[model samples]
Target chain A: MIRVLEQIGRVFLRLFEETGLWFTMLWRTMAWSVRPPYGVGEWFRQMVRLGVDSIPVVFLTAMFTGMVLALQTFIGFQRVHAESFVGSVVALAMLRELSPVLVGLMVTGRVGSSMAAEIGTMRVTEQIDALEALATDPIQYLFVPRVIAGIVMLPFLVVLGDALGIGGGYLVAVRLMHANPVQYEINTYQFLDMNDVWSGLIKASAFGLILTLTGCVRGYYTTGGAEGVGRSTTAAVVNASLIILLSDFFLTKLLF
Target chain B: MTVATNMEPQSDPNAEPMISLQHIYKSFEGKEVLRDLSIDIARGESVVIVGGSGTGKSVTLKHIIGLLRPDSGHVMIEGRDITEMRPVELNRFRQHFGMAFQEGALFDSMSVFENIAFPLRRHTKMTEEAIAARVEECLEQVHLHGVDGKRPSELSGGMRRRVGFARAISLKPEILLFDEPTTGLDPVISDVVADLIVEMDRTLNTTTVTITHDMKVAFKIADRVAMLFQGHIVEDGTPAEFQRSENPIVQQFIEGRAEGPLTDGTNE
Candidate 1:
């Protein structure tokens, strides 16, 4: 029992040390990212890779979510003689919460994990060291581009997710639910204000920052080669998703 | 005081050293890897650091390039201290050197041309045409002219090594550091890499510090050889001097003996 306790204490110490090292590296990377010699081209390429390439998945997920939300909202409001408010509720919910959170989760699974694996591989292979030897700052050349691209492009994806989701609600409510199309459209536009869209965009921006920072931080500290890269990738996605979800709640409370 | 210090025999007045280390000490987890190690390589000289595994050979190279800091020492390049340089200053200092990593480290996402052209595109304001021309020249130097369009995974180990060499020399650095240039290669390929190292030094007049355990490759190209053992240089001399050295560590390593100090596991 004493040995077990001692082992646990050792593991805690190791975690503390690793966290300190990771924070130091992240600070260095963030400090260097804003300086000159920007890889503008790489940033654009990453924007296309992260944002444009992820549209299909975001659209599919949002459409289904919107359809199901409309169905559930209509059923719940029917007993209250307020089924007319179903379209408004579904649209507002999808725009303010579902779109940002869903897109954030999707990107965490796709781009965040890949970034960790790629950077981890580079670290283990000494490519990052090679860049340093050649006088090329890896943070400026690599991390800044991806981070800026993520921040710039994620808002657009969230907007797209919002639009597709609302359209899916429109499809289900008008064609299937036999609702008055004019009333449904009017209710959506009236209830969903600019604040709803802005709030979703805010969430998207925060999620993007959290996702990229966590991914790059995990990857930058990865060691030991293939196994290490694999572990970092998994850790990046899980940690990024958790942070985004936790922060989303805090930000929503503060902003709303 | 200054004049007296300059007059000391420890300072070479005639030939300025291209790279120098002074009282370099580095330790990891309380285990010393380098213990007050100091050495100098003259301009345009090729010095090979010969040591068995874990003799701080690679650590020494990393220190020279400022990848790792000495616990308490100074690393001087072209007579300037780089031990405590800031990021921008370090990058500027590093621009003067190029390193070929042991694994060749080709970016899988990029084609060979892109990988070779990476440094040029990153550092220089060169036009695409000029970058292309430079990439072609580098590829030609490594006898990899037509393979630029291929991905790294499509290439063989030797081809990848050559590509790595091409990328290393792309920026026209004055000093080159090679970490195990001939490691994990067939004998023929090792000979090819060794010849390329020699040819590049002759053509570019570049100062080179190569760390290797392959004595055959080392003897082929090193103008001077330094044998590191137990965190210190046990022998420093010409290849011939090293071959004839009576130092048991150097003799045991060069002869590849399991009975020697390297495999005894007593040093740790």
Candidate 2:
């Protein structure tokens, strides 16, 4: 029992240490993101990679999620003969929760993992050190642009994903479920407002910060070798995902 | 203490060294790597640090550039202790240095011309025309001709290292560091790198600090040699003095024999 308690204590201690290091990276990224010799070109490049390149995957995931939700709602509501509520349910679920959360997870998998791997490879290969030796701030030159890109692009991606999702629901409901197209559009519009979409965009912005910061922290501290790069990349994906889920709860409570 | 004190006088013969590592000690994950290493390099001198594969040869060079801060010691460069510097200050301070890595840590994402042009693009306010001329000159000096737009992945190993050297010296720094510069190169290429080192020292008058296990590279480039054993410098002298020394460890290392003091723990 004593040994088990000691192991738990060590785990908590490690968590605190890791949190402190992560916060330090955030502070540095914030400080350098505003400093002189700004990385305008790098920021735009990351915007294209993190935001523009992710459109297809986020769109597909949102579309399928909306279709499934619509079908599921119609099936359940049919028992009470309340099929008219399906459109409202689909729109409310999408704008308030599904689009932000699903798109966040997708971006975490795609951009976050890739960020960790690229930076980790650079670390192990001494490219990071070489950058430092050449008098360039690695945090400014490498990290700030990525974090900024994620923060700015996630909302835009969420907005696009939300549109695709609602459209998918419309297509499924009117064509397949034989619902009144006018009634479906009216219900979705009346039940969903701009506030729901705004809350989701806010959540997406937070998730963007989480994914990029976790990736950069993991990659920056990576040591050992190729094996170490592999470890950090895995850790980045896992930690970013867990943090996004945990924060989603609090963000939902606060936003609602 | 003395190195920090002699900061003012520019032309004095008794001025402090250009680089000094005093009483450095470092460890990684409870494994002691360096335990009280110290060395000094005067202006215009080429110093080579030689040791076995893992005796902290590269670690010492890293400390000099502030890449890895010593657990406890003074890494003095240009009469200032670098351990006290902020990251921003350190980046500015590193402008005085040019380091060539073992495997030529060129940016694999970029082409050779862009890789060599990185420092100028990042740290300097030079025009595109000036940057181009400078990069072209550096490529010619490193003897890599007409391979400008090719990616780092497209080059051979020797060609890649030469490009790395070209990149390192893009700004024509005051100090040059070579971390196992000839580790995987063929003998002819190694000789070419060695000649470049000599030419840099003679013509550019840059103070050089190189770490290598290759005694031939050491003897060819070093005006003085420092032998690191375990974690400390056991011998410091001219290459000729090193050749005449009777220290069994130095003898084993220079002679490439595995039967002497250096091979003590191998069979134990």
Candidate 3:
């Protein structure tokens, strides 16, 4: 019993320690972002890599998710003779929840993992230390560009995702389910206020910060070697995904 | 156990040492790595630290550059204690030093030219043409030629180490540090590297400190040699003085004997 209690206490202490480190990294990243030699070229390059290059995967994931949501809603609404509401349901879900969440998850898997792997390799190879020896702050040289890219570009990805998702729902409902085309179009816009769109864009920005910060933190402190890089990459994806989901609940609660 | 001797060299009394580690103590996970370790290196001196694996030779080098802070104690550079400096201040302080790693540690995303040009581009306001000229000069200093467009991954180990040298000297820093510069190289290449270090110290006139286990490399490049044993400086002197020292551990290490106090505990 005493050993189990000690183990539990150790786990909590480790958790608190890790949380403190994460926040400290976030603070340092923000502090460095405002300093001189902003490296706009590197920031823009990361935006292209993390956001633009992820379009294809985000596109497919959003499209299929919207289609499935429409299909499921249509079948359920049919029993109640409320099949016309399926379009509204799909649009509302896609804009206010699914688009941001799915885009965040997809980018976390793609860009976040790569960020962890790249920086972790640098850590193990002493390239990061080399930066310091050259009078460069590794945080300013590395984390700022990536964190800024994640923050500014995630909302844009979600906007594209939102459009594709609604379009996919339209195709499923009007062409396949044989719903009234004109009503489906009208209903999709009817229930979605500007508030719904704003809420999701805001959630997207928060998730952007979370994912990038997690990746940078995990990579910056990585130890061991190739195995450590792999571990950090995996941890970055898992941590970002879990935090995105967990934060979504709080964000929805706060926004709505 | 044979007692180790502290064989510090005679120096001018009035002149201060350029770099000093004053009684530093460091530990990792409750295991002490450096204990009351102290050493003073004068300006324009080429000092080589020799030790067994994991004796904190690299740790000492890191302390000199303000990369690793001691658990307690001061690292003094030019009479100023760097352990009291803030991160930004320390970064500014680091501009005075250039360090080359064992494996080069070149940015893999960059070409050789870009890697050498990195510090020049960051720290100086020199025009691109001047930066190009300086990069060429640095590469020339290391006797490397016309591999600018190639990636670090494409270069041989010796070539990569040379490029690292070029990059380190790009800024012409006041101090130059080499962490096992000749490690994992062929004997001929190691000899070339040792000669380059000697040449760079002469031409650049920079205070130099190197960490290595190779006694030949140490002797060839060092104006003075210091041996670390059990987290302390067990021996320090000129190369000749070091060779003539009566310390048993120093004799055992210099002879490269497998049977000695160094391996006594592990075998049993």
Candidate 4:
């Protein structure tokens, strides 16, 4: 009983410390966001890297997901002779949850992991220290560009994902399932409110913030060596992924 | 060291140190790295701190640059106590310093040219043409030619350090800190880097505080030598004085002796 209590206490202590570092870094990054020498060039470069590069994967995931979701909806609805509702279910689900959540997870793995590895490697090789020595705030120079890019670009990616996903549902509904095209369009439009799409976009932005911070925090404090960077990268992806999933629950509850 | 009449340059009370560390005490986890450590580096000076591995030589340079804060002490850079400054505030102070790390620490993401131009690009409003000209000039000074497009990973250890030196001198900082700049290089390459240090010191007139285990590097580059032992500076003097010093810890370290205070069980 004592040992278990000690373990629980240690975990809580670590969580608090991690939370403190996260908030402190977030605050500094936000403060630095408004500071002079705003790195507009760096931000655009990162947008191209993080957002532009991520579009294809996010697009593919959403498209395939929509197809699968539509197929599943058709299977269940066909049995009940309620096939008219399939388009409504697929559109509502994609707009309200699937597109944003899936895109968040995919970006967390792709961009978040790479950010961790890059920054963690920088830490191990003293490149971050070199930045410090060069009189450039790493938070302002490095984190600002990345975090801002994440927050700004994630919604854009999600909107694209949502479009591709709905289109995929349309393709499957009309072409594969042979649903009436006009009826399917009407049901999809009738079921999805602007709030559903808006809520998902907001959740996407929140997830983006979480993913970017996870990479920065893990890399910022990375020690040991190459092995340490590896560990931090893994932790970055895992933490970002966990944050995305957990926060999705809260966001869905609040937004809905 | 002659106990009766030593000619080593003692810290002149009247001379103003461009950088000073007074009673610095630092520890990592539970291990003490620096305790009651004090040193004064004068303006336009080149002081090479030599020590065995893990003796806080590099830590001293970091403290001066405000990269590491002492647990309790004063780290004054240019008459200002840097230890009291926040990390963000330290950037203003660090502008006065240019440092070259052991592995060069060049950003792997950028080309050699961009790596050298990083400080200039960030800190100055110089146009692209000017940045290009400055980068070429810095590269030429360090004797690296036409290798600007290459990544740090593509360069040899010597080439990387040359790039590191080029980057460090890009800002023409008042103080230059080379942390074991010759550690992983061949002897010939080490001499090349050492010569660059001398040339930089002469041309830029920058105060240099370097940490190294290489006596040859120390002898070639430093106007004065300070030996750190077990977190304290045990001996400090000129090249000739360092060569003639009778201190056992110094002797053991310089001579590579397997027995003495360094190798003695008491320290362990």
Top DockQ model: 3
Q: What is the docking quality class of candidate 3? A: high
RMSD in Å for candidate 3, one decimal? Answer: 2.4
Lowest lDDT 10-residue stretch of candidate 1 chain B: B1-10
Model 3 lDDT per residue over A1-256, tens place = 9999999999999989988998899899999999988889999999999899999998999999889999999999999999989988988999899999999999999999999999999999999999999999999999999999999999999998889999999999998999999999999998889998999899999999999889988999899999999999999999899989999999999999
> Mind sharing the TM-score for model 1?
0.93
| lDDT, candidate 2, A1-256, per-residue tens | 9999999999999999998988899999999988878869889999999999999999899999999988889889999999999989988899889999899999999999889989999999999999999998889988999999999999999998888888999988999998899999998888777889899999999999999989988998898898998899899999999999999999999999
lDDT of 1 by residue, B135-212 (tens): 999988888768989999999888888899889899999998899998999999999999999998898889999999
| Per-residue C-alpha lDDT of model 1 across residues A203-226, encoded as one tens digit per residue | 898888778878887888798889
Q: Which residue runs of candidate 2 sit more than 4 Å off their true CA positions? A: B1-13
Best-performing candidate as measured by TM-score: 3
Q: Of models 3 and 4, which has the larger DockQ?
A: 3
- Candidate 4's residue-wise lDDT over B1-268, tens digit each? 1111112223565666788888888999999999888877888989899998888998988898988889998888877999888777888778899999989999998999999989998889999999999999999888889899999999999899889989998988999999998898889988988999999988889999899999989999988898998887888888888889999989988998778898787554
Clashing pairs in 1: none
Q: Which of 2 and 4 is ahead in DockQ?
A: 2
What DockQ does model 4 achieve?
Answer: 0.85
Query: Which residue pairs in model 4 clash with each other?
Result: B1-B246
- Candidate 1: where is the Cα deviation over 4 Å? A1-30, B1-9, B266-268
Ranking by DockQ: 3, 2, 4, 1
* DockQ list for all candidates: 0.75, 0.89, 0.91, 0.85
